[model samples]
Structures are given as C-alpha cells and as structure tokens.
Target: MSEKMQLVIDGDSVAFKQSAGFEFRLNLSEFPDLVKAHLAKVKPTANTKSTQACESLGAEVLEKDFEWEFLKPFIRDVCRWGGFALIYAKVLNEK
Candidate 1:
C-alpha cells in the first residue's frame, strides 16, 4: 500500500509520499510566500521584490531542468518544522 500525507502551509498544501520513506513534493504554484522565503535565503542579493525573485529562481530551476541536488536544500529547509510548522498549524487549526 502507498502511504501519503499532506499539510497546508500559508493556504497552500504540500504532499508527502511514502515509499521507502517520506518524499516531499511541494506545490509552489500555490505557495508563493514559501518560494519567496527560500529564494531570499538562497539568493539574498538577487532581488528585493519577492515575486521577481521567485520568478527568477523559478526560471533558473527550470533552466537546470529541475535538478534534485540544486533543489534538495531548499525543499529540506522549507519542510522543516521551524519553517512550515507554524504556518501549517495555523491553517490546520482553522478548519
């Protein structure tokens, strides 16, 4: 059987699939804030505008054809308790 879980953060949901272990798949299409936060950390000098920074980073990721090594750190950080928990708890508690 396949096991999966989901948590909503900042009005957007991220899914975790369990095969051998949990694998995170983020839906950035719905969570611009998360993406922006990540970009700010990874590319601090790039842009002050969150939207623009996200777009630029998105382009870079796409240009690299979604390299896992390039994306893993960002994904790991965003999924961390300190990063997403408060947001997730707030959204979950509301429902």
Candidate 2:
C-alpha cells in the first residue's frame, strides 16, 4: 500500500501520494523556519505608505501588506505549475 499524507485547508482536504511517484514526505507542521523566513521578507516593508512616499522618487516602496505582496510574486512563479497552494493558503486561517 502507498503511504498518503493528508492536508486539510478551509475544510477541503488534499491527499499527497508519497509512494506512487514521489519519495518525499511533506510535514507542514515542520516548516516553522520556512514560515518565519517568508514572514521575515515582509518585515522591512511594514512601514506606512505615507512614510514610504516621503523618500526619493527612485526609492523602492516597501509593500504595506507583506504577506499579500510576497504572494504576488509567488503566484506568478507558480503559474506554470497550476495554483493549488496559493488558493489553499488564501482560504486557510493562519491566526
């Protein structure tokens, strides 16, 4: 029998087949570092928009919503792979 891992997000469940084609196991609970690293990218951009605009015109704008901004790039990158996790995360409650 193939070993399967189940991931439930927003009441919907997805079964990841670990033995059929892939040999890896994904432990969502074990990704604290990954989560932290992703959140860290948003920290610098936490400043208010008015404060950011006061800087030079050529200066980069630190996105107000870090989580949302980060996902934009990620969604574009994963467009070829089909968007499952992005939708899943959008519906899931992190808090």
Candidates in order, TM-scores: namely: 0.27, 0.23
- What tens-digit string does per-residue lDDT give for candidate 1 at 1-95? 64655554433546665555676767768577876676567542322234354456557667878786645433333334234534544443453
Weakest lDDT window of 10 consecutive positions for candidate 2: 49-58
Against the reference, the lDDT scores of all candidates come to: 0.51, 0.41
lDDT digits (tens) for residues 1-95 of candidate 2: 64765443423333344435653444566567766775555332332222223332113224444366554443433332233445545543441
| Per-prediction CA RMSD (Å) | 13.7, 13.8
Task: Let me know the TM-score candidate 2 reaches against the reference structure.
Answer: 0.23
Candidate 1: residue 46 Cα off by (Å): 14
| Model 1 TM-score, all chains together | 0.27
**CA lDDT of 6 in candidate 2?**
48
Regions of candidate 1 where Cα sits further than 4 Å from its true position:
1-49, 73-95
What's model 1's overall lDDT?
0.51
Error of 1 at 17 (Å): 26
